[model samples]
Target: MPRDADATKERILAAATAEFATHGYAGGRVERIASQAKSNVRMIYAYYGGKSSLFDATVAEALRRMAENVPPRPDDLAEWAGDVFDHHQRFPDVLRLSMWAQLERPEATAEPSEAYRDKTLAVATADASPLSPVDVLVFVYAIAQAWQLSPAGLTGLEEATDESETVAARRRSVVIAVERMLQKGP
Candidate 1:
């Protein structure tokens, strides 16, 4: 593909990601994405076949980026959780997109892709513990995402002295918790 075409596609994906995150697949508008991308609506359909396909492509790209940039490190689970948390902080849209997928596309069924299976398998066999690698992963992902929603980690807390302080504290908490889990015995 030409450089210009690739750039245009990226813009479309960016716009589409934001749109899906904000409005979900049911509420997201093709016209709005096109407008945001400064491209014609027709091009989206031409490029992605339709709104559903565009959403799938948008999510696929997000997953691909996560798998590539934050591949799990089974040997160092704490660091891996921190890296995943950082990725979530950097690309908050990915979390929103993931939430929208769960809430709005509950009926859509697709088997886990090979990349996902490999990562889960890697974690499962990386160490011996009462909890399986898959369970540890689930625990880490849940806490990290929950922290994103409430960085203070509990209700009725005063705001942080600095935004980065809250993130640092939350990251530390996640890392420590995962490390402890890794040290547990069956």
Candidate 2:
């Protein structure tokens, strides 16, 4: 792509990401994203094809950022969990957007979702653990996402707070529960 064109596409995606994160897929509007991007609706369509495509880009970018923040490492589950929670805390709106997309159009991106999931599972399998590969993945992601999704009341933190003591306490509980389950192996 040409320099200006590439820059425009990046800006459009950045705008769409923030917009969707704030409003979710149902509430995200191309018009609003375009306005925020300093581009027109036509430009968004021209660059990204359409709203669904833009959503895909937004998710991909979010995931990429996530991967950057916390690449999988077997011995670092605690740190990894912290990174995941921090990412969600810093970008809670993105998580909300993802939940809406997951609910609304799961089939639309099942392939990528499964691929991403499998890769994560592979990371868990690298651990010299007692849990089955599937169980490990399920437990790890379950804990991380649950912690990310925990309400402020459950966490006893400001809704916008990130990785508070309460939140970390919740995570520790998850980790202890999973460790016990692994030790007891089904």
Candidate 1: Cα lDDT at 27: 97
Could you tell me every candidate's TM-score relative to the true structure? 0.88, 0.76
Instruction: Assess each prediction's global lDDT (C-alpha) against the native.
Output: 0.81, 0.69
| Candidate 1 per-residue lDDT over residues 1-186, each given as its tens digit | 444878889999999999998999999999999999999899999899999888888877877788898887877878888998999999999888877877876432132366667878887787645686667777878766767676544733846468788778878988888778778665
Write down the TM-score for model 1: 0.88
RMSD of each: 2.7, 3.9
lDDT of 2 by residue, 1-186 (tens): 445987888889888878887777778899999998888999888877899888877777766666666565556554555556666767776677677668765544453465566556765667636666665655666676786676858755545555456666666766565555555445
For model 2, give the 10-residue run with minimal summed lDDT: 106-115
Cα error, residue 174 of model 1, in Å, equals 0.7
Query: How does candidate 1 score on lDDT?
Result: 0.81
